[model samples]
Target: MRVLFILILLANLGVYALGQGWLGMRPEDEGRDTRRFTQELNPGAVTLTPRPAP
Candidate 1:
């Protein structure tokens, strides 16, 4: 039982490291256009309005 628990723990750690991008760039982020974020027009002009209460 202890061996199984240790194996599971290591697997979880490996997944966590991959998700955190500790190894390298994440696969999902490849070929993504990052310039759009910097090219926003009047980004500060957007405002969040509170919804009316029922």
Candidate 2:
């Protein structure tokens, strides 16, 4: 039981160090997928109705 606790603690410490850049983990550059879907979207056809005074 004590060994499991120590292992978990060490794992958490390693993750914290990696997150804080202490372990020299660099950020990865991801490529964006610029493929557009063929769906028709009428964004300029919005009609806003005014509400009556309460």
Per-model lDDT: 0.85, 0.71
Q: Which candidate number has the best lDDT?
A: 1
Tens digit per residue, CA lDDT, model 1, 1-54: 999999999999988888887877666777888787789789799999999999
In order of appearance, the predictions have TM-scores of 0.54, 0.47
lDDT (C-alpha) at residue 41 in model 1: 88
Model 2 Cα displacement at 15 (Å)? 0.2
* Model 1 ranges off by over 4 Å: 33-54
Query: Which tens-of-lDDT digit does each residue in 1-54 have in candidate 2?
Result: 999999999999988887776877424312533243454478679879899999
